[model samples]
Target: MPMLYLNTRHTLPMIGLRVQHNTVDTPITQPRYEQETQQARAGRGFTQPKITIDSYPSRHSYGYTNNTDFARENLERGMSEVQKGTSKHTQMAWALAEDGPKAGRQVGIEFAKRDMEQRVTRQRTLVAAAIPDPVIQVDPGQTHGAPIPAKTTPIWHTEGKAQITYHRGSFETYLQQKGDIHSWTSEGKYDIYA
Candidate 1:
């Protein structure tokens, strides 16, 4: 082998590094609205419904995702309730109320109970997060571990409210007394077909 030992490392070809790209599918679903867009519900899109929030409330930092979900759900429920009165499909409800349902007082009471049930469920499910234990030890021989702090998550509860006035007066007097219905502006308030 004498002095014929050449540097074999110098004869080897250099193999460069390689990079790869991963396949990804990003699907975006556009919002669906019968007569408006997301921005409209946000209070500033296409014809800006006058019944927008008079003031924007501050959002919680710790409960961002949760609160956002709650807000969306709350809004959806409210919109659904409103749609019951506005949507043409539900217009039959009014007609049905006329001929099908008897004892308007009892029917109203049942509706109130159902509304209460929904409200109760909504309130209870508002705060949904499980706190994980940082350190769980069987023996207390070493104080290097901090017992899991039982986290008390803050809850944003809704009072579930609706403005109602039971009057012994006529419908005309009632409407006149209640200048604004649905919290619309004075100029925006209007009467519905009786």
Candidate 2:
């Protein structure tokens, strides 16, 4: 014979189960909740979220410096002013009054010449900074082989079917050995298996 258990508190006996009821509701108390809510509704207690963004050049990006561009623009602008006889140097030279027109033209031309020289120097400096000289290594005691002449034919023209097949095989082998293929399924789940 097996024993039976019953919960007699309910009208129907509940076997292998217990029932609990929470009739009283507890109120949550937050500090200044009503005051803050009222102030928010009145547009008095809220501030817009602050967002900041920063930008920087990528490590692999290749470009000239801002100073180079500025130098070029400044040179052009100064030359234009000189041509228009509106440059400060030209005006100052004309103020001397002894040979106003000739003095002004001479000063303006000198200023334009100096600006061109500075612009060229800046461009050269930038080029130097961007490209470095290659380093060569030599073994003095080792016997050297005959120099190989550079090939004139393009690599694609020289490559045969066997070479292309070999390259494909090598690439496939590399992918099988080291590649991790990830994909997304139609069910919106990520799959790691290829």
Candidate 3:
């Protein structure tokens, strides 16, 4: 027995290696006008709209999924206010009239209050709906842990945004006459695993 001894090592065969794929959806940044105008240039294959950053003071960032109509309406309101004016300066002038300061002051105060309210409302609307251009990428590894089970069905998920960025003026400084409106762009990132 000692003279005729044999050694053997056993190994298990590997079935298959698991693989994952990730796809990212780019954020929509261009306004509707641009989106439509690009159609002519797009021909057939070019679907994505391209926008250039204007010289106007605006923020470029990611915006969450939102109602474009709402944002557009508010934008129109803001534009209208800019065109027609908020009646703030006139109200102040009336309030400080020299001869009839007392009577004029009362009417001026009312108008001033109304103007302030309108400005605040306008600002909040813009801020609430302002969506800035944002870039989003999905990392499959981060989305799902390693060692995924073999022969599993694909999974779909949307990662909550870390931050929401939007264009337009600040809510705090709505009263200031910045006098311009910017396009709203919104974007979100999602991960699909298979």
Every model: Cα RMSD to truth: 63.7, 47.6, 54.5
Worst 10 residues of 2 by lDDT: 164-173
lDDT of 3 at 145: 28
lDDT of 3 by residue, 1-194 (tens): 22422333333443443334343445644333211121123222223344544422223223322467558868998998876664655545655675345543466557667868887888443345454344434433222223423343444444455433444332221232323433332234221120
Top-down lDDT ranking = 3, 1, 2
TM-score of each: 0.20, 0.17, 0.18
Displacement of residue 52 (Cα, Å) in model 2 is: 19
lDDT of candidate 1 at residue 83, scale 0 to 100: 85
Predicted structure 2: clash tally: 0
What is the full ranking by TM-score, best candidate first? 1, 3, 2
In order, how many clashes per candidate?
A: 0, 0, 2
Greater-TM-score candidate between 1 and 2: 1
The top-ranked prediction according to TM-score is: 1
Between candidates 1 and 3, the one scoring higher on TM-score is: 1
lDDT of 2 by residue, 124-185 (tens): 43343444333434433433344444334322222222311111111111222333333333
- Which stretches of model 1 miss by more than 4 angstroms? 1-92, 95-105, 121-123, 126-194
What's the residue-level lDDT of 161 in candidate 2? 25
Q: RMSD of model 3, in Å?
A: 54.5
Give the clashing pairs for model 1. none
Q: How big is the positional error of residue 158 in model 3, measured in Å on the Cα after superposition? A: 76
Window of ten residues with lowest summed lDDT in model 1 = 1-10
